[model samples]
Target: MNIDNRIKFRHLLCFLEIARQGSLARAAEALAISQPAVSKTLKELEEILATRLFERSKQGVTPTSAGLAFLRYAGPSVQALRAGVHSLRSGEHEAGVARLGVLSTVESSLLPDVVRRLHDQHAALVVSVVTGPSAYLLGQLRVGALDLVVGRMTDSPQIEGLTFEHLYSESMILVVRPGHALLQVDLRDRSRLGDYPVVLPLAGTTIRRYADSLFVQCGIALPQQRLETLSVALSRRYVQSSDAVWIAPQDAVRQDLARGELVELDIGLREPGGSVGICSNPTTPPSLATQWCCEALRTAAADYRAALYP
Candidate 1:
């Protein structure tokens, strides 16, 4: 089938947006069209290509195998077209752009320094960063919505089609406010954790798995009075104002630790931490800006590891 004659750019746009959003209504909103219109476009594209694109359900849509395959080409093609238009409108040479996905683990420490150095070195380059759970970020990376992701390598089905490079290992720390009652308790007593309210990452996140494993290894049950979130701001606030213990990545609360705002509890689980790293779609060649950002991230990781180990 001659796709040039049968398919329009709008078809690719609609298809890509649906794949990204995983819902017809959400894709329609994003594309500024009615849901039926987006659905119609998807049907037309599927017919043209002689393949079913998405598997729809009450919750939303997920890309079929063919849809996932098509997304690799469609997403980059659309992004390139947008970059071209932006370049033309700005009357400047096409500056490189990298869309990055980040996990919360690196949000406070590794990401900031890397972004600062990237901008300092490439003033005209555009870097867009999106932070989310590793699973979601890796999904976007697979579909070409993200150039790369900085996060822990998870043993998840979504990680199947991507490549990951180990940068460092990140351990979870149990922390409390500066003068919490737990400070006087024995560090080895895991059961004492139940005496206080707890803040933890939402279930299913990579770090949360490690956090949960720590409790299991110690033969301690998760606290009944628990707050589950990935928001560092909320966890920090709650831990400081109340006797809530926060389970978080050491990197995430580094500043607070240094400032004596939070104190680490020494439960002393010897389990090795998760591998922190970079994940990218192996099929998508990195653009100039993406390559530069990758290098910056490696440098930042190197410095961080040296500081920790040295």
Candidate 2:
């Protein structure tokens, strides 16, 4: 394939911004260039491709099929170029940076271990971590804004178009502070859990489905009084100080359980649990730092996962 020598980074940059903003004017403002310059650049790109890339309208510009096709390649190229430029700018000795998105489940245990291992090996490397729901983070991953997404997001609908590698399986655990009254009795008693305030994952999350299922499996009704949240820190803190029982991802409360700060209610789960792993865009060639982090995640998870399931 003979690539056009006239095609430049500027052309792709302009096209991406125009497609993203849906207007030449907005793209111009973003790029700090005049609208005419934006139009001219788009024209040059279209000419180079010998195809009409976008259709102009009173509302805005919409990408033609060719434009969308160009966009898929251009987006990753720009992101990789930007990341490479960033690594070079950081310093010759620096290990570089990897952007990672973490869903809530692994944020507490597995993620920290991965980071610690990575930094210990390459102190100069910066690992930027973004925390959010699976859908949002996976969307960023598919767009190449994120290098890798960690945690249990295997069940997310947004996981389409990405690859997930399972490191281990995790399940929800019902926990409460030590010496709680409920701790003395049979946890299977549906009425016993309802007496104290309950802490749960926010409704609609993958973890919440497991939490809800636990109750149904045990024939327990949803507690009338419950604190709905996504914050592991908040839920852990709240559960420790009060009689509130927290339904948490096992990893989230692992340390607490080990240190005797929290105790799990022995309600055995029939199912293995949610899959915790790494999600990445197989199309994107990983940077050195990302490669290091991925290696670290796999190495660390081997030991971590062994202890978890065994």
Candidate 3:
């Protein structure tokens, strides 16, 4: 069909706004144009398509059959354009920017290796890392502000349009400062480990959930007189300064453990661990920078697994 290319883009924008807002006044309000302007654009769009795209009535405008069909193609194109803008604005001419959110545990335990490996592979890649509780990062990811989130999947909120790929499972363990009394017993034995004061991660965190589950399975209720905090450093310090055992990821305190600064408490229960993953909105076509970051993270995960367990 012979069609003017200029009107197609304009018509698409105007029609999309009307379709989105469902009312001429609202669409005009949203577009910062007049109601007449909106009506004119819709008319032009209908003229180009040679069909009525909306059914006007007292109830407001609704998409016609033709409009419904066209939206399937148009919606994704618009979204892709937005994604492209994010990629370009972040300097697409350069390799790419990987905006990632890593969970605190992974940030401490697994991220260094992943980041180092990622950088080694993509020297030109600009890595922008944001750290936070899992829920906040997921929110950013949902709104298209972040490229990827590396965090515990258990505590993850429902983020529409996102895909999650499981990276690895990590055992939650009770850790304390060096020469803690709990380490003297079998960590798998719940009764012995429950005797000491506890330093716990916040109750609802993924790590804490696993830690709590293990305690429950061992038929031990954690001590009521316990200290709770979100900061891994603070939790570690609490354990170090006093006769307290803190439940956390072994990797989060790996350096302290290796340096004889902390010891894994013998909590006599076999506790299941939690899973970590990379999350992104799968509906949007990922930018080259995002792909680079994903690859880097995967490589980091691989190298970390080899170093930690191999």
Candidate 4:
């Protein structure tokens, strides 16, 4: 279809917003425009595609079959274009900028310190931090959507053309509200852990997988409870008031532990240690900003390791 070039990026963006939000009114509100403006833009899109993209029903707009198929390709294209433009705009004269993808786990653990150090060292460089699941983030790095990712190497992730450098090691622990029975050294036994209701991250997440492996390795079944979430705040709240033991990275709950808000299990459970690291595509040369960030992350990991373990 030789669609006119006048039907441009904005039109596709508007259509995506409507598709994502499931209503023209919501999409218009998100775009900070009038509802009629959204309606007019969708009309332009329908004309370009030569078909109805949305089924207008009482339930609001739902993408038609053709629209669904088109978006599967278009969405990624737009994201890639945006990433490319951001890269170009952020490039430097001698040492270009790099986008760093960080899984939330690592971001919560190490990024704050690393970013500060990076800024202090490379005053003129730009580093954009992106977040997502490890699998998704690695795919983005492979396709130049990102230059590097700070992620946990808790499991051997299966991805091609990527290199992992071990930045530091961390151990998992059972965290709960201060003065919880589990923290009582006398009650902090293996059998006690098996008896308590535990709040755990979803099984598929790296931390949960590691905890499961630890339980299996010890030949013990974890006490049944809720497979909750990865939110530190929510878990912290649960631990503060309930008899829920949450398995989490030591770094994630360190401050709470120090403040007497939460306590780590002294159960002497077999430690399940994992490496936190930096990942990048081996095929591409990393920009200076990326290299700097990697070094800064390593430094931060070292400092954290010393504070937590030493």
TM-score of each: 0.92, 0.78, 0.68, 0.66
How far is each candidate from the true structure, as Cα RMSD in Å? 2.1, 4.6, 8.2, 6.8
Best by lDDT: 1
Least well predicted 10-residue stretch by lDDT in candidate 1:
86-95
Model 2 TM-score on a 0 to 1 scale: 0.78
Instruction: Please write out the lDDT profile of model 1 over residues 1-310, one tens digit for every residue.
Output: 4446788889988988898788999999999999999989999999989999999899999988888788767877776676667667764556777899988888877898999999899988888999887777887786668899887756656787678889988788889998888888786867888877889888887778888887788788988999998888888999999999888888888889999989988777634668888888777767788899889999999998998899
Clashing pairs in 3: 114-300, 187-266, 187-267, 187-268, 188-268, 188-269, 189-268, 190-268
Q: How accurate is candidate 2 locally (lDDT)?
A: 0.83
State the lDDT of candidate 4 residue by residue for 1-310, as single tens digits: 6747877888878877787677889999999999999999889878877899889988899777787666655555565577557666644354446688886566665787787887788777777888756766765565455778786743645344468898777777878877776665574346666776777766566767877776665566988666567676677787788888888777777777888888777665745567888887665666567778778887888898788679
Number of clashing pairs per prediction, in order: 0, 0, 8, 0
Ranking by TM-score: 1, 2, 3, 4
Question: Would you list the C-alpha lDDT of every candidate in the order shown?
Answer: 0.84, 0.83, 0.73, 0.73
Select the stronger candidate by TM-score from 2 and 3: 2
Give lDDT tens digits, candidate 3, residues 1-310: 6656756555666777776667899989988999998898888877877888889999899877787666545655665666667656655556666788777787776777776777777878777888877766765565455678887765544443468887767777777777766656655556776677887767666667887886788788998778877677778777889988777776688778788888776544446587777888765577787887777677777766677779
Top TM-score prediction, candidate number: 1
Clashing pairs in 4: none
| Runs off by more than 4 Å, candidate 4 | 1-97, 217-219, 308-310
Model 1 gets an lDDT of 0.84
**What tens-digit string does per-residue lDDT give for candidate 2 at 8-33?**
98998898888767899999999999
- Residue pairs of candidate 2 with colliding backbone atoms: none
